[model samples]
Target: MQAQPEKKHSSTCDSKEDSNKLESRYQFCGNALRITRDFSNNLGISAIIWESGLVLCRYFEQEKISFSGKKVIELGSGTGIVGILAILLGGDVTLTDQPVVLNQIEFNVTSNIPVSIIQRSKVSDLRWGKNEDQFPTDYDFILGSDIVYSPHDFPSLIKTLQHLSNQNTIIYISSKMRETMGAIDFHEKLLPQHFNSELVHRNEEKEINVYKVTKKAREQPSA
Candidate 1:
């Protein structure tokens, strides 16, 4: 959760490094701006989103951001483009991911957003289910894009939800079900933990699905 600046990844031209990048991510609107690469760490990545994310852009423009004054945290913020837009719409937002991706996040946010919106965005590194004390307490909403996939990380991912939650926090997850059994299972196991699960949108071309999750409390919160 700490926002310490780490080593800056060389954005130089090295084909070898490019080959190691697990995949390239793009905006949902067919924008070739943001590209993602999983570095050596399976739990971490570096993102290259220029101009903002298309998926995020659509989401904001479709609906006026409801989280106007609420604190919002975007997990695995590859390029942090979504969180930046959230800030534009009036949410107090934090964009988080590994240090590897923070640099690129900086590039995109600074380039696309106006100075006012940029001021509301905070960038930090958060390794889910691990060191998370650096994160803000009790986020009103949690968001992630294309994060779930590995079964091994399922337990940790699930646990991380509780870590960032308060008595009432909404979780929004968007992912493309690209033929992964592990990712499917993760969703199934995760369904029961929430108070409600509903499909928000589906992108046929990308095979992406978005869900809105409400947390259920078994008992009342302590005053």
Candidate 2:
């Protein structure tokens, strides 16, 4: 939840040539990523990179988490930073978000990741409640950053998670805890029934937390 300093600039690119945008650089594990975002655009909140995303990336990088040959899908992947890092770590990743933000996700994936590693990644359009058929259900890891804020979207988000995961799938989420309490409520609602949730890391000063979620085991029938 460390506050990010803003960097503004004008850029010409494939998606929207001749537009003003905000650009930022994040570095982790000797790798650096340059991301461009359009906060003033009609894409709304999906255009900005949040502190929780940065904290999650930092934690994974510092811990040397291995994603080698793993299948990973990132939900609400604004700027696609976490998914990009997964690709760098040898994961086959799909970076997904609402359709409007897919262009930005694609741009970041192509511009920042080298051709050698870039082949391991793809960008897909995904809305939380809908499009369940569009994605594969057997992902090894599911990632999300700063996505648990909206109370209205909670049910859809949870349903989407259930649709994507198998019994062995591991879900990672990073969220900023603010006055709204929406993120906290999301965790409380997803308890022993659906997933076993754990608070893996926290930045108390910034009010950010990283959670590791695993699907709960099914009950065995008595003979």
Candidate 3:
């Protein structure tokens, strides 16, 4: 006889060890979200949840942004907290990160989000500057949180953002305003030519800034 397959179970959290690693509970719009992060630093920065992610999520809830039927993509989705919140706001979301972090993204999405919302969301492996064709370019909203920490990756990060955005796309980036490696440098490199940058929200307590990036309007030529 063939061996029976192992049974699968679903719960509000992952295993005990995983919860012990890094667990966060959030209450948004009367709904609760629990995100678990379980990975070593060797896997990459995606193993931890940053202050920018938390600030962004709070801003979204406070503003009550309606994402109904919107297509959104999150780049460098660590712990997938922001992507999960996007799904809660009714956006069809794709959470993308490096291959090593995809499993953690899926785990958080499955454990925290409801089945209906999870059905409209997915996890994908996307490396900046490479395999650009693999990701969709027609997203209405592009999201990134704490993705600009390294100046070395700035070029690739900008390239990825440009590849994913079009005339009608809006990109929201939440970054901690650190003296070193903050997003101001990245914004300086993005203005006038690529997109119009607006500082939408700032929280001094958390030291996070939320920026809204929109495509620049084309200039009309003289006859």
Best-performing candidate as measured by lDDT: 2
Answer with 1 or 3, whichever has the higher TM-score.
Answer: 3
Comparing candidate 1 with candidate 2, which one achieves the higher TM-score? 2
lDDT of 1 by residue, 1-223 (tens): 2211112222222222455453333332222233334454443434443221344355545544466888999988885656765665678888887777777666666755568667777888888888676675589989877777666776776777767876688887776565564656566566556546556655555556666776666776889
For residue 178, model 3's alpha carbon misses the true position, in angstroms, by: 2.4
Note the Cα lDDT for every prediction shown.
0.62, 0.81, 0.79
Model 1 ranges with Cα > 4 A deviation: 1-45, 48-53, 219-223
Q: Which lDDT tens digits does candidate 2 get at residues 1-223?
A: 3333222212222333235676677776567777788655577788777888888887786567889999999999988988988888889999999888988888889888888777799998889888966787899999999988888887788888988998889898988986485777677665445888888877777788888888877789999
The ten-residue window of minimal lDDT in model 1 covers 1-10
- Candidate 2 clash figure, as a count: 0
Q: For model 3, how does the per-residue alpha-carbon lDDT over 1-223 read when each residue is reduced to its tens digit?
A: 2212212212133334553366767776555788878766455577777878877777777767877899999999989989988998889999999888888888889998887567889999889999767777799999999987888887788788888888899898988866587456676664435788877887766677788888776789989
Better of 2 and 3 by lDDT: 2
Q: How well does candidate 3 score on lDDT at residue 25?
A: 73
Comparing 2 and 3 by TM-score, which wins? 2
The TM-scores, one per candidate, come to 0.71, 0.87, 0.85
- Residue 163 lDDT in model 3? 86
What is the TM-score (0 to 1) of candidate 2? 0.87
Instruction: Say what the RMSD of model 3 is.
Output: 10.8
